[model samples]
Target: MSAPAREVRDVARAALAWASGRRADFALGEDALAADGQVDRSWKPLGELAQVCATVTRHTPPGDPLHARAADLLAFAWRQTGEGELFLRLQRLEPFATYPLEVYAALAAAGFRHPAYEAATATVARTRGWRLTEQEPTRRLGVLHAEERGGIHRDEPREPALRRTWLGGLPEPWTFERSAGYALTHVVFHLTDWGRAAGGVPGDLTDYLAHWLPPWIDTCLDARMWDLACELLAVAASVPGLPGDTVPDDAWARVAAAQDASGALPEEGDAGDPAAYFAHHYHSTLMAAFAAALTAGQGVPV
Candidate 1:
């Protein structure tokens, strides 16, 4: 069966309505300054809207019409959420078909796609911008995640690798692949890095990853980010001796052996193929729990 042609207009409208109200707290009025001088409720609306965009983007299938529209929405919301890196990253990832229809409708209906959106996303090299460089190598490495180039030598600069780096020390370009290769390598690399930094042991890797992941995740309202977090967690479990992995099968049973000893099981019916699951559904829920746990000084089981 074929995919829908995308209710490109509808998605664009949704994105706009969600984004339009984000600045009131940061507006010129009294609300902008909470006397405490911190950016107040301004962040809440923006964070909520960014999650909505991420939710839509996570559920929409790649190559679907709405998918591209959602990507543009993802871009806009990321700006509102103050995560310009994710905004530009997602903008660069927005497929071509979603642009003409989605962006056009948004431009027609809503002045311009957010003032900050344009400024931040203006320079992404789309298909129109793909350029062949003559200053480099002879070998071709096929496709890339966030860069315009197709090939890289073994000794190539690590800058491109750094662009997609985010939560749990995994890079988006690598993590987005959702493969055993990406998962295993990603966890191992981070574990190794964390372990090495902690005098070549696992003593404090959890603290570092836990401490570093949330802020790096920025507005963890997006569902995709949450799903990514789960995958990372699962990857951690798969490692030979992490808490979740090291614990025997009986340990989880024991953890759940007494109702009083265990917290409620994650509101049921979440099991599925982790790689194939829609990122939007599980991302926010996962992050919310993760955040709540962090606030209460808890940790994921490996």
Candidate 2:
């Protein structure tokens, strides 16, 4: 039910290799550069690449091949944002929109800095409007963490925010559904700082997840929902005392099997429409890399 560290490291390297080869595709389009046009297509993907690659670089030390490649990919992703200037420009263009800051947080946490963006964001953070911005519970947690990552103080408390989330409530296990699954995983991600702060997950929720995550992951796998399944796997890896028991041998094997030889993972059972491949499956592939890096970084033999 397990593989050596190198096996999981191979998974991490392959996924980053694939991402590095596709680096150009993650660039900001002309429209996105000028305005908020096609953000989901342009900005979101780029941000995700930065986030996952940053995690890979953080977990893998400098000498390792995986670390070197992941660092290269992370640097490439940073360039796509014009070396942090683009985020500053976007902050001006969409003062209320938090995506730019949220995306910037990944790089910021990885030691990439943008003084102008930080100053502007700090000014905004002091506004009453910023504090009162309406957001779903999970996203609210995201913004709070983003502010924290950038060293901008938000006059808000996190515990109350946690108590408001779907995962925070420790909701009925059977009521779990697709949208709710993503919500819960993100809750874990934000709570644990995407596995950097494993103890951040409350003990009760840790126990709750230890009991429920396996079946939840199985359900995603059963539905052939590779993306969410990978996300759920990431949740398992992020929680303290969960990885050894929660991540089943077959779960990693199934996810690994779904990965293309080129390292892209399909959203579902298979990679559909080769012509639009990366567009269709980029997030899932990124999730696979994210999960793999976290799994391996924890020193768990997957």
Candidate 3:
């Protein structure tokens, strides 16, 4: 392997190691069951952990160290969800809430099935309440993906949902901003099922992404938006034959340099309070691991 490729793989490995070490910090709180209490702090992090670990397991061949690390992490995360029982309870607690199913989908995709939860969601999926629920285009796509993984038939066709997104318009390149950047990355993510289905990205959108994604990556890096930049990098890797290298080695080097000794990546230029480290840096660290894992799938499996 070339030096750059190996370095990128190291980034993936280190980031995953950091995440696995901090698995306990991802626990849900007492308020998690309350309607006012949300999953953003607790369930969100665990779900992100599950999602990235599953993605790593998906891209890496079995028996590889990275695959094993990710698998172990996935198992730990599944246990955190009470072996999928928490989702069933969450569904019963909030029948109309989609986050439980959203979080459940990641585990579900990685060979972790919850029959009771799936069965309950299947019945809910047929209800008018679930069908007519309003979500922004990106979230709508997420729900569809969750439904697919949860064994609930999709409430809406994906194509229309795709077109409704900010990235769907193929808007003026100059109009891109912070929120748009994230929205665009997620649009690509959901379209490709977190890079598992590259063909899900349309030819036109793929071409557009190929042409424009590099600058967006560079832009994020320039602003030190490591989390979103890594996310954008994953989008680039998700597209097949995405022309020249989507992120130049130096950019990858910058990302690697930004990584802490423990393998966690900061969301911005500097790591903030140590006490709040997980809250501030978990997502970006997860993104780095995710990008490296997906990129590693391109040539030699990492």
Candidate 4:
């Protein structure tokens, strides 16, 4: 393999090792509590873990130990609770928030088939409406999640036009502003299904990302926003016709360097105290693993 590909594979292997070791936490629900003492009383932890495992398995070859482990873990998590209970808990926690929908979408993408997920999503659509179609691009990615993962399909023929308008309204002259960078990455994620469904992204939006993504990745790296930087790597991996080899040599390297020996990458650039390790690092490490898997699997047909 080429140097960059090899680097991504190495990082992916390390992340898989780390994630596999956390199976106990995942199984026993210990990963549900945040460092701030806020417990994820909903299905967020299981959903997130399922998403990570699904994404990893998608890029991994069959018979690969990591792939089999991820699949097994996903099944285990699914069996722990029913979709109806999870959705009901999520509704009680935040009925109007977009996160529940996103979580459901991730589960669906991972091949966790549940009628309750579809029913809950449909109910939310009927009650909450398709805010993603009407709202700003940055705020409505969860809606895109609903659409892409078979949660709620919009029947409007003007969908492409709507996408164009939304893409056009995004703040231009992208800077190192942390929130903006984060939003841009999410915009790309919504457009590309976190790099797994790049073909569906509109051409203009894809072109826009192609132009601005490289410099934005550099800027985020310079600012020590490692989490956002990894997200940008995911965006790069998603753009079609964009050369797989064009990914910056150091992008994966920087994230890998920040990873603890235990396999967690910090939210920012530094690992915080031990007390906050799972809360601060879990999502970032997951994103890094996702980026690494996506990058390493590049050039192979999806």
Clashing pairs in model 4? none
On residues 1-302, what C-alpha lDDT tens digit does candidate 4 reach at each position? Answer: 67666667767777767767776555535333223323353355656677777777887888877688778777766665564355555555555656556666776787766676566666766653444446664555546565558457765443543454434454475444777666666766666666676586667666676677777788777777878888888778767776544456687777778888988788886887888777677677777878877775666332
Cα-lDDT of candidate 2 = 0.84
lDDT tens digits, residues 1-302, model 1? Answer: 11111122222333233233332422223332233423323433333333334433433446645346545655564444344333333344453212222222222222223344333333433324423322111011111211211111133443343323332243333243334323332333333321111222233434443443333232221332333443343334323334323222222222122111112112123334546332222232322222222211113321
Task: Name the candidate, 2 or 4, with the larger lDDT value.
Answer: 2
Worst 10 residues of 2 by lDDT: 1-10
Q: Which stretches in model 1 have alpha-carbon errors above 4 Å?
A: 1-37, 57-112, 115-302
Deviation in Å, model 4, residue 14 alpha carbon: 1.3
For each candidate in turn, the TM-score is: 0.23, 0.95, 0.96, 0.81
| Alpha-carbon runs more than 4 Å astray in model 4 | 24-42, 88-98, 128-136, 147-150, 156-170, 174-176, 243-246, 300-302
The superposed Cα distance between candidate 1 and the true structure at residue 274, in angstroms, equals: 33
Q: Considering every candidate listed, which one attains the maximal lDDT?
A: 3
170, model 3: CA deviation in Å? 0.3
Give the clashing pairs for model 3.
Answer: none
Angstrom error of the Cα, residue 253, model 2: value is: 1.4
Model 3 vs. true fold: TM: 0.96
Clashing pairs in 2: none
Tell me the spans in candidate 2 whose CA falls farther than 4 Å from its real position.
Answer: 1-7
Ordered from best to worst lDDT, the candidate numbers read 3, 2, 4, 1
